[model samples]
Target: MGRILLTGASGFVGGAIHEYLSNSSTHKLTVALRRPMSSLPVTTTLAQIDQIDGVTDWSRALLDSDVVIHAAARVHVMQESSTDPLTSFRKVNVEGTLNLARQAAEKGVRRFIFISSIKVNGEETSLGVPYTACAEPAPADPYGISKMEAEKGLMRIASESGMEVVIIRPPLVYGPGVKANFFNMMKWLYRGVPLPFGAICNSRSLVALDNLVDFVVTCIDHPKAANQVFLVSDGDDLSTTELLKKMGRALGKPARLLPVPSGVLTLAATLLGKKTLSQRLCGSLQVDITKNRELLNWLPPVTVETELDAVAKDFLDKHV
Candidate 1:
């Protein structure tokens, strides 16, 4: 294996990938990021990739790589209307992606690994039905739409460029240094806060950071993964109540789950416009990593129990 070029080296997901490759391998790692790589080790080269011009100025990073993992993406969050999210996503996900893919073909890179999201399949995975690699895409939000568009674009590039492409779609990743909802949960659990969540028995797909990175590295050279889309998970689905309980267990506290009816909670959340939490609590989005496990012959290295404990210990140690 030759040098590998990774974009979005500073993002949460990308940084995890960068950390994994940086500390665990002898293979050359090249990163294209906005800020300097001084924050990173000296061995990691700081390659500048101008966002607006990377399409035309990719020779710097895509020149000598065995593969290029496009982890950098424009994540569309709430209240991003003025941002013209579709165009913003296209600038990076589609145009930037093709630009690098074409350059890789010209530069003779062997493979292209893309970290996609499960949202491409849809915002809502049917109850009791697991989303699979063969499921058709039905993105509901701008972010999901952009990821879907980029996936199609990448497929076209892979078709025309004669380079192997491995696409991975992971759902709800959590681990050490975890932020967003996961961090919020840790905060709440640390304070021994009660949750109105026992009555909810919905399940959603989630992957631990280590498992995600492990799969990405596995697909890097696994021939079976070439030009294929794989849905990945921790190989086990956990309910919202179960997740909170696990967090409590990890924090050495007992979960305070109220036995309120699921419908009442959904109604109250809807009225309060807290639908995001509503859906996650009462929704279903399980992924059958059967394809990933059987095809790539890979299973997640970290179990949910271990991952949850590690997350709590790391956060508690840092914040305490």
Candidate 2:
């Protein structure tokens, strides 16, 4: 059994990974958190880290770690408060990640798995032209830029220290306990709120939380996953209208959608200073996962319909 160190046990993606790994018999898991959490399994080891920055010491947590899954980061915020947003993101996502990686390498950690975002590839893509693993980096936002920088630094550390770095970039992970935009969409659908995205034909790729967790666990010991960059999704791409309809079916509520023109929606959003939001709703962003299939022989374990059903059930159970 190998010892695995997991950071960001309190966040959405990290928490899901922690839960999945907690039931595993093959690995000893250590969770690094800003503070102690009462909900973690009793046998789980806790490493308290108040903050993550270039200067934050991770010596205690790096002990005897065979694999380090760095999942914590300064996620994008809707209303950013920092005067210098890029610097703020760099401090936590870039500098903090490299700091942890360097320390993990010194501690003889064999593998470092980084949970990155699809934003590292770019904000959007052509309808049929998906970004592949070898795509040129074109991060458009501060959060994406920070993650890209972190990936570059990790690669350097891997070359210099002989530590394996596996990077997985996933887009719009959704399932149980999802928050923000996805959750809002579920709420709107459940409440029978009519949306103006019925006619949007742009495709977007999304990852199910279970599928992502399964892939990450597989990568923990898979020889082919070492020092590799992977782009992951549900193996299914859906337009906004299709997604809403699927979600409505899952929620047992037929969606009430108005046939609004995409151009008109974009214009309205632009007038209201929500151009980015409109783009996200109307623009296509897809990732090609052929490399993942050929290299690791991996496929998303869960189907989109099944995962969306779970999401709908969870939302109904908790929110209703």
Candidate 3:
């Protein structure tokens, strides 16, 4: 059993990780939170910090920790409010992450697991040519660029301090408690809204919340995971049309999709200043997890169909 410190305990992904680790008998879990909460499990310890930034002190949280899972960051926002988005992102994602990592290293933390996004590889990929861990980074957005910079800084810290770093880049993660676009799609489907995505055949990879949490736990003590970068997914790719149809099946409401050409949709979206949203729906972004399988012999424990069904059920339970 090892002592582990977890950040972002209140977030979607981080909450799930904390729940999973808190139930485990083999590890001692301590969570760093921006504020205190009364609902946390009694087995878990809390470390409160004012905010995450370049100079946030993490010394108290790093005490006697064997591994640090850095999951909190300035997440990507569809409608960005910041005038200088990159600067805003750098302050949190880049500077904040490096600060925590340096402290972890100095405190003799064995491994630091970073939850990165697949956007580091770029916005889109060729239909059949998914991105690999070794691919050159071509971040197109401020959020992606910030994560890339953080990864670079973490690697430098690892080399100089001998603290191992494990980076996992996951694409769109969806399951219960999901928000953003995925949840929007579910809402549209449930409302029987007609969507013009029947013709969108571009493939995209997605990871389930359970699968991602499982992989993070796997990397905690897996010797082979040290100093490695991995791209994780469900090992299944789906087009926008296919994904909606499957979600519809899970939700007990067949999607009402109108067959619209991808080009026409792109043009309309561009004219309406929603080009990025269109690209997300019409362009392919796939990640190859061959490295994950070969290196750690790891496989996603849950299937997409099962997880999607759960997501639908959860949505219905809460919304209906």
> What is candidate 2's CA lDDT for residue 184?
96
TM-score of each: 0.95, 0.99, 0.99
Candidate 1 runs further than 4 Å off: 52-56, 79-83
Tell me the deviation in Å of residue 120 in model 1: 0.3
Residue-level lDDT of model 1, residues 1-320, one tens digit each, is 47889888888788898998887556678999877865776556678876832445778787678989889887656457555777777777777777777788788988999888888898667768999999888877777877787788778888988888888898999988988778887798788788788877788889998899889889877888899999988988988888999999998988888888889999999999888778877888998888877787888999999999889899989987
Among residues 3 or more apart in sequence or in different chains, the pairs in candidate 1 whose N, CA or C atoms overlap within 3 Å are: none
Report lDDT (CA) for all predictions: 0.83, 0.94, 0.95
- Output the number of the lDDT-best candidate: 3
Q: What does candidate 3's lDDT look like per residue over 1-320, in tens digits?
A: 78899999899999899989989998998999989877767777899988999999998888889999999989998999999999999999999999999999989999999999998999999999999999999999999999999999999999999999999999999989899999999999999999999989899999999999999999999999999999999999999999999999999999999999999999999999999999999999999999989999999999999999999999999998
For candidate 3, the per-residue lDDT at 179 reads 93
Which portions of model 3 miss their true places by more than 4 Å? none
* Model 3 pairs whose backbones collide: none
TM-score winner, 1 or 3:
3
